[model samples]
Target chain A: MDEGRRPDDEKGEAEETAELLREYERQIMALPVQEHVERMLTTLSGLALQRLGIGEKEPAACSPQEARLAIDAFRALTEVLAQDEPERGGVYRATLAQMQLAFVSVAGGRAAGKGGAGATPETNGEDDGEAGKNGEGL
Target chain B: MDEGRRPDDEKGEAEETAELLREYERQIMALPVQEHVERMLTTLSGLALQRLGIGEKEPAACSPQEARLAIDAFRALTEVLAQDEPERGGVYRATLAQMQLAFVSVAGGRAAGKGGAGATPETNGEDDGEAGKNGEGL
Candidate 1:
């Protein structure tokens, strides 16, 4: 009887886990494709903000490479949505515009910190002069 | 010969369109599932910000209902990712934390504007006094 009880308890737990998984799968499948897309969009936006160090508590989290990929991926998806669902696309466009603005701000800050990496010779010189002024100010 | 040419040209155009669609589908299929999820996350983030009227040029675009849905959807998706993909999910958690802060700020502003709509009676009375002061100044 003890042996039988041990086997039954294991089986019962296994069955319960399987049932839970099946219910989870069913809920996911029941959601509309658009809802899934919306969830993805929200996740990507958060990733972008994190990568850009926007609103991040830790500025050290900024990753230019990851941010670029996230932003590019976002633009590509939004462009497709714009054509397929123009009504909702307007909101996407607005969001993209703001993201671009944020990217520029972050990128500009980085470039300035690096003394204008990839800047033209003239621009580099100008940046150096500005840095000198900033140094003086400090 | 003219009739044949007309029919052939129409068939050729249809085939070209079909080929283009197939190419697009192939490109989409070749991408890793993670990329799709990333793109969706970005889109959701943008939608959330747009709904929240954060960084939005048009203040009228603010919709509390949509913002709530976007934020909820973002959190749900991020929570799943935290379990399924913890390495990348760290970024998601950071994003969610920032998002919550933004939500609190926006919600607080709205409540203030509404003269503490859902505040305690004492708080509401205090808000009304503040409003009275502004009204007198006006």
Candidate 2:
């Protein structure tokens, strides 16, 4: 977090990240580490979808409550992963920061008497088209 | 990708990954990075939500095309991230891997003429309860 400090040496950073990963692996031994992260990711993704009302056939199906949960789960885990390893956690930090912003945007938008993600159907529709055309499309 | 050989020095792998991340970042930069990833994440999640169909006013709103798009984008990015940096990219690899599986599940289920994520409503409901107790029930 130092403003003027140089980034961690990539070599040292990688080694430290590897060590932390091993420790995390041991910490999550009760469940397959992959499976645990997947579930949390899926939960967050699913709830975000609902908040956007994309999975629904009706007008709006946003559930801000559920979306918050998914976001929390992601943040909670990533924060743990980030502990004592800012260099290694940079990607997750960026990833979660964007997510946090997007979630807050939606929440804030709704609070301003606008609407949830559903408020921008036209924009979302365009994204769907553009996103659909890019590679495997899946 | 070496099967018999041991992993590279953390230095070697980290350098390679840095190179790859730069490549992927460049590729993504043409696109509004945040919007693009959010769309992909939400698309996949929305598909998952449709499969679950919680809080729905009607039947499934599953879109195979959009779901495929989401899965494709996630895989494409993560695959790039995972190259040569398994140690540092482990979290992203795990994150996207599960998303790919969940997206595939939804897609495969659709192809097989089965239900969507809606098939997993029971489990999702419980998550809802647990999520509600967390702060910021947004």
RMSD of each: 22.9, 19.8
* lDDT (tens digit, per residue) of candidate 2 on B26-128: 4543333233334434444444344333234544333433333334434443443343235645765665566556545544444334433344323333322
Clashes of each: 14, 11
True contacts kept of each: 0.02, 0.00
Model 1 lDDT per residue over A33-132, tens place: 4565655566566666676778777666566444554555455556545543698878877787777677667755665666664553345433233322
DockQ for every prediction shown = 0.03, 0.03
* Stretches of model 2 off by over 4 angstroms after superposition: A1-31, A54-59, A84-88, A114-138, B1-138
Identify the candidate with maximal lDDT.
Answer: 1
